[model samples]
Target: MENIRLGGGVLLLVLLAVTSLFVGVIDVTLQNLVDTTSRPQALQTLAESRIPRTLALVLAGSSLAVAGVIMQMLARNRFVEPSTAGTVEAASLGMLLMLLVFPGAPVVVKMLVAALFALVGTALFLRLVRRIPPYSPLLVPLTGIMLGAVIGSLTAFIAYRTNLLQSLGAWRNGDFSLVIAGRYELLWLTFVLAVAAYFAADRFTIAGLGGDVSRNLGLDYDKAMAIGLAIVAAVSAIVVTTVGSIPFLGLVVPNLVSLAIGDNLRRGLPWVALTGALLVLGCDIVGRIIVHPYEIPVGTVFGVLGGAIFLFLLLRRSSRVS
Candidate 1:
């Protein structure tokens, strides 16, 4: 049954990807690809724009989802993700500083700086959460959200003063419209990092059992956490540096999969990845068609949808606890 469902999800993703390819303002159909003269432009569009956009969607979506799984496991909180934990916000700040201080810095430099900030931000969040005296699980997410908001506000204020609000907004509201072959290659790094985390999934799952229990189980809990933070930081940094911040992706996708299939990362990772990719791609398509020539950012659509789901999950958890 799991295999069947996973297979179905992959098929659905392929269909959506095909839809993604042909849904832009400029018409690109099967016939356009076949016609002798039009084929050049059609092929160029597919090669330079549509295909890269689709790949970016999948890579960014899956990376964020997988990062969410790792983060939630390490934090032992279902609601925790990079965006919630100040990782993405920190990355955005790093990118903004990079933009202002060294405007000519290469993308890789910007990404590394962003990753450093993200790592520090995540470490601070985990530290704060740990020090708060064993409390409700809800406090974990609440703390993270608060930390993220603080970082986000600081980033916004900096951008406001520097007259870089437009660039900051672009990063804050992720849109794949400007993604082309060369422009979006950084997102592929996230795929590699996500795969690395998958190989160490058991360590994180064990670590979630708490420090003593994981150590008793022969896992290095602190080491696992450090590695997990790095992975999450790198993934968040790459995504934000490449496309911008995508709100609620890392939070919503993994939690939804866990609710459906249980918290085991090994078993649920595939579903999380697929669902994440699917939701982002579907939202992108909707954003394009919903307004014809004018397009809504994918971040806007997914932010609204994911925000609703986040509220639902929060309320449902609170009700169950009550």
Candidate 2:
């Protein structure tokens, strides 16, 4: 049954990728894709724009998804992803700072700033977790959400002060239309980070057991945590920088995959990556189809559906605990 479910999810994801190629703001169809004798403009658009944008989405989606799973394991909770844990907001703040302080800085410089902020944010969240009482796992995400809200508000204030509210809003809402050949290269960094994550999967699983147990097992708990935080930060900053803030890709993808496969990252990591890419691709396709000429951002679609699912899970867990 589990294998069947995984296989089904993979199939759905592939369908989404294929469908995405067909649907877009422009009138692109199979005829356009197949017509080798078509106008030069059609081929130019596909080769330059659509293909890179779609590939960027697939890469970003998978990277963020795996980052979420690693984060959850390190934090020992299913709900504490980068979005909930303030990493995305922190990265946004960094980007805002870059644009404000050094308006002419390169994209690479901006991304580095964002990565630094995200790493610090992840560190802060972990520090807070260590200080909090361990009895309630529910409080972890709650604390994280509160932290994110506070950071988000700060980001808003800065945007308002700098007179960059519109640009910041675009960044927060996240649109992939900006993705093109030169810009999309940053997203590939997430793929590298994901590969590094696979190598450290066992250590993450061990660290999830608890600091004392991890130490007893001869693993350096703090070092393992730092590594995890670094991975989360790198993956998250790249996603935020490449596309913008995607609210629930990190949270939803990992959780859904974990539901199908077990929690062991070694066993479940590949499926998590596959499922993550699928979900984002499918959502992107839906966004393109629903709005027609003007498209809704993938983040918005995920926000509506993902928020409802997150709420349902929260309520269900509460009921079970009580």
Candidate 3:
């Protein structure tokens, strides 16, 4: 059954990728690909625009979902993710700082700065989690939401003062419409981070068990956590830098996968990636088609759906507790 579901997800992702390639403002058809006259224009659209956008969707979706899994493992809370934990806001602040101070820095430098900020934010979140008593599982995510709100406010204030509020708004709303070949290459770093997570999956699964158990098994608990958090930070930073802040993607995808497949990171990771990619691609397609020639941002679509799912999860948890 699990394998069947996984196979279905991969099939769906392929279908979406193909759909995305041909369903754009500028129509691209197979005939155009072969025709000598229109071949240049069709191929240009495919190579420069559609291909990059699709790749960005896949990389960003998979990376964020995997990051969410790592975060939940390290935090020992299913609700924690990059967006909720203030990582995205921190990365946004870092990008804003880069825009203000270095203004001329390359995209890589901007991403590095954002990653640094995300690391600090994640560390701060973990520190707060440690200080608080885990009386309720819901408390952890609420605290993270509050932390993210604070960071988001600060980011907004900085942007306001710098007269970059409009620019900040654009970055805060994840949109694939602007993606082109050169612009989205930074997301490749996220792909590397995802690969690293796969290799380190066992250590993360053990770490999720708790510090004592991890140490009893001779695993370097702190080192594993550091590595996991680093991956989360890097993924968040790169995705936000390239595609903007995609709300609740990291939150929604992993939790759904965990609910379906159990907490074994090694076994669950691939499903999370496939599901995440499918969800993002599906949302992007819906966004494009819903307005027909005037597209909605993919982030907006996911924000609505993810928020509803998050509410459902919260209510379900509360009901179970009761």
Whole-model lDDT values for every prediction: 0.91, 0.85, 0.90
**Candidate 1's residue-wise lDDT over 182-300, tens digit each?**
99998989988888888898888899899999999999888999999999999999998888878899889988897889978888888888998999999999999999998999999
- The list of candidate 3 runs beyond 4 A from truth reads none
What TM-score would you give candidate 2 relative to the actual structure?
0.94
Candidate 1 Cα lDDT to native:
0.91
Higher-scoring candidate on lDDT, 1 or 2: 1
lDDT of 1 at 73: 86
lDDT of 2 by residue, 91-208 (tens): 9999999998998999888989999999998888887887778888888998888888999999999999989898778777767877877888988888988999999999999999
Give each model a TM-score: 0.97, 0.94, 0.97
**lDDT assessment of candidate 3:** 0.90
Q: Considering TM-score, which of the candidate structures 1 and 2 is the better prediction for this target?
A: 1
Clashing pairs in 3: none
What is the lDDT for 198 in model 1? 81
Candidate 1 stretches greater than 4 Å from native? none
